[model samples]
Target: MENLESENTPNPRNPKKPKVVIVMGATGAGKSKLAIDLASYFPIEIINADSMQVYKGLDVLTNKVPLEEQKGVPHHLMGIISPNVEFTSKDFRDSAIQIIDDIISRNRLPVIVGGTNYYIQALVSPFLFDDLIEEMDDCCLKESIGDKELEYKFASGNDNCNVDYQRLKEIDPDAANRIHPNDFRKINQYLGLYARSGLLPSKLFQGQKWGRTDNFKYDCCFVCVDASLHVLDHYVEERVDCMINAGLLHEVYDIYSLNADYTRGLRQAIGVREFEDFLGFYLDKDYNADTERIILSTEDKMSKENLKALLESDNIPHKDLLMESINRLKANTKRLVRRQKRMLNRLQALFGWDLHYVDSTESLLGNSYDSWPRQVVEPSVDLIRSFLHEDNCTVPTKIPNAVASQILDKRDLWTQHVCEPCGNRILRGAYEWEQHKKGRGHRKRMLSLKKSKQYLVDKEAEAVT
Candidate 1:
């Protein structure tokens, strides 16, 4: 699959304005396909919301859309991590906002697509890690050490290191019930935050009310791609088969050779454990083979024989085994899809209800006219009207040229910083800016820019200040 450079197209429908289009669905539900299709119609760039697809060397297993399939639509946040690296929903939320802003700045629609519901919700709602961090600070929270420290502090060298579990039960019973006793990471985060801050993390999280319309400017239209369970199962089965055919086993083998821990998030990804089992079984059969001749046989021959034998074997019956596995997978997939659909419905309902609730509250207080629109909207409209004459609406008058110039300059600077190179402003201190400058393409551009008189003067002036 060839990666194509993304071309920017100005959206004439909403000229000089940006919009966000969020595409959400469960895994194997064709989110990427739909996003690509949407991009074909709109001036949009796709931002991945899937947590698993972000890791490098997990394309086939994670079902990441190939570069060729993206149809030259720019995709962000895919393959951003090594298989061995760690990532979180918080990280995704932070990265996605920046990508969305960048896309908007380029006069393109920001299309967020993936099945990771938490990540999507975090983006649409105010419930973010930054908010959690603020809560932690307000409550005077401190970080907790590893399980060992948690055990020592709580139990004071008791035989049972389950003291952390007991403490969680005492502080936040609901969280304790949901969290497994052995889930050290979650238990530690909960217990540590509570112990240091005197406020339960769960309670702090639960207290924050959401579903306010004033949060975002965009007209959000959530489109759910619905499919029957039978159809979804067929899709998953076909996708799994494709992954296997696309050297998924080989990829798993390569990853296994890296000697990374399987318990970590990357290895714990779907299909990794199953593929690892397949590899182990293959190796064990070769180990138990009787003859040196068999051991010396070609890999193709070994694989063919194994495949034939497995296909022919009556032990555990391949049909029944596959049917059973597929049924289980289908059931789980259906449950997840149903949950996602429910979430979407809830969000839509909440949005509608919130609007009604606000209106009702205003009416009840006898301040129906003193709404947010009165305070913010009328002034903005007046400003816009005053700035633009009826016939000569070429430019806004109230908005100063200097301010407009600065805005345009900042936009240009951001574009240059995010673009190929040479036009970047170093003082912005964006991480992507640094990466852009160090890139090979950017370095070549810098070389060309250095030869230009105006570029050299700008560089010299930048350096002098």
Candidate 2:
């Protein structure tokens, strides 16, 4: 570890916090490109913040920047974790912090870039509520639940384990009301927090200064490379198409198994789940000797068209399923783009983090290859340069809005609501609750309940007469 005192020293204005640059955006939004381009201006190392990219395998599915494309710049924490292990946000935060420290130690700028906002959130915020949940999973839960017993019950779903949830409800109904009964992790965490500290987690942890800007560990220059949804949606679809052309199926095929858990590890990526139906059908032994020969013949190529033709000639239903699976992959990737954008907005609006937005819509729509440097990279570089120089001229100071600051505290974002009229469907947050109220199903249920009440009243009066 090469130690460099120059860049590691605290800024004169804010002596406590060191500078770190974070590049964030939606999927297929050129966040990696922008971050890599920054290396020309400043000595920097890139840390992968995207959750999927951290896991090994499925490089095409995760869209990791290839070694040649990385332009000889050092990138850390990408494709290092085992494909089967569940790497939590705390895992990312801890690893990234160590990498960032090393980068700063060497006098290189630490440029953390990815679409995973929670990973970034966990990195920036010193004491996130999610950290408590992670802590419980690590240290606290073992003491409260008994380590080996917890492992057994968590894996087997023992009926007697409801004792922990019931205990949580008894101690803190407010916390218990928010978490679902089956969510053993949170149930145990809340119980662990209460038992360990003798304090209600609902009151103590619900809405602390977790994601606030002032409470962040470092002075961060947040750069979001964003574009219009229409452009991003089109780009995401195109990228998925390109990934398919680039042996994405082959990557997925190598990892496919009959008993593979889709909810865990790299299998949870969008591309993997969408192809389960097709893979299950293709891999089934009952498909006959001819189908098996066709499958074995195309093992090397694994071309989508080749698979489609085999399915079409043998079974038309299987062919349609394959096509639908490919379409689903594209659709799911687009949905991920939208979701990542929404989270970025939430971080800015709710958390009061000063995010410098560089709109790439125009460049993406026009001559992207030529204009990308000007529209996205150059503007992001300027913001970061100003940030490094401690110039407030280009950067706006974050003014914590009192109402917005307290909103999470006053109303827990994780607070759950169950609508009994709507078949006991659970909804989280005020926004989701309001949306459920306006939904047709909820309205119909309420109307039926009202009519039933009126009919019962009429029947009772007739009986009395």
Candidate 3:
């Protein structure tokens, strides 16, 4: 095995934008491992960008790098926030900037590792809506005609979200049509911004140059750790099973609340929401004292085995529900992995992100200790090394003509499609709209509509004859 090391020590404090290395990928792609491996060669700190992992608990469920696995590297923003607080991208950007600055001052390379691409996007791009809003002076924001009345109506409206959305459409059709109608927070934000700035939110957004390479806040070397779909599916299922064995259920049980909101904070994590049904049923069941004791006992392998035996003996239906929730957790996580991969591709193509690819399919599938460093880690370290030492301050990966030809057009990228045939599901961007059209449900809906139309036409012809 080669002694992996960073060839060039970066003087990020000098003229060019302070360099930051971003490791992003789908779940179970080993992004965290790759980032941590950089520590062997460079003085590095890991800044976790995983949305779920930032919450205070659910370590097993979130698959946070166990402290031992982190290789004694300083990791920031992992399990630090209150699980109840809805941490926004703005919060991440603000916190990350401070951390990045601090890391640079200390001359340690900051390696951002996670599956949450939006958080990475917020950090790199300057056109974040919140960031833009913060720059405007209070005096520059004045009340326009009917602004107060519109605000009052929206504030006092009887939960009529449609009315507020309609008002947004009247004022800024482009903005209103770009977002989902049910996204009340976004609708409210658009309305408020328009009222304060005396301009359409869409208009205000113009010339912000979102996703433009030139507008990046830092010299970032983006590395995407990827694997084949089959490999990822297999790996994710195994990971979920491993998490369950590692007391994932116990963590979920710890936070199980009858009225917990799944859309908020840590509850939004895949594992936590899936077990709600089973946990709800288990609590309501009239189990024996021994079974209850086993359930409440420390969640170890023995306790799990005892609980399983007890459930099997009692002929309780809870076992099936438990299995169902576990299956759901696995399925949802796989879907999430696919979505994350798609977003990374979109970032590369539409947003012109120069993502250096690291294929971990072999390492993941074979589970070879040697192949991981040789194939994945060595390439990544080389890329980061070149990025730091090179005059361009970037890894020299050429953008393909296909991606380069993709014009940086936010209007097209943000174009919204409401698939009425598919229950009026809102899909943002042309890529998502295309994907939605290719879905089985959408095709089935389209076929049903066609058959209904043909039936009506035939009946009308018969009546005419």
* Predicted model with the maximum TM-score: 3
- Superposed on all Cα atoms, model 1 deviates from the true structure by an RMSD in Å of 25.4
Q: Candidate 3 on 259-297: residue-level lDDT in tens?
A: 577768999898887988887766533335554432332
Error of 2 at 310 (Å): 5.3
Q: Where does model 3 exceed 4 Å of error?
A: 1-14, 143-173, 180-182, 285-316, 367-369, 393-398, 401-406, 409-411, 418-425, 434-465
Span of ten consecutive residues with least summed lDDT in model 3: 1-10
Off by over 4 Å in 1: 1-18, 129-131, 134-163, 180-182, 210-219, 257-263, 285-335, 345-465
**Quality of model 2 by C-alpha lDDT:** 0.77
- Compared with the true structure, all predictions reach lDDT values of 0.55, 0.77, 0.79
Tens digits of lDDT, candidate 2, 1-465: 223256456557856566888999888778998988888888889999988999999999899999999998899999999999988888898888898888876778899999989899889888865566556656754576565545544533445547777766887887887887767667766665665445688788555777888898987888988899889888877887788778787887777765566757899888888888787777643334554432344444444446535534766767777778889998988878867876775676566777888888877787657678888878887787777765342755343467556754454455788899887887776756775698777899899999999999999999999
**Best candidate according to lDDT:** 3
Clashes of each: 0, 0, 0
Q: Which tens-of-lDDT digit does each residue in 1-465 have in candidate 1? A: 111122223356644323455666555555566667655346668888887888887677677888888899999989978777667777787788888778767767677878776777777666664566446545423444245335535553344437777877887776665555766656766765665556666566545544433454343434444444455656666666666567665566556522345655678666655444444444423432354222323543334224324434674544344334434544555566656655554444333211101011221233566543443223323322322222122223333445544433332111122253455433222323554566676788877766796877989999999
Clash number for model 3? 0
**Regions of model 2 farther than 4 Å from truth:** 1-7, 10-14, 128-188, 194-200, 286-315, 367-370, 391-393, 397-411, 417-427, 431-465
Q: Candidate 2 clash total?
A: 0
TM-score of 2: 0.77
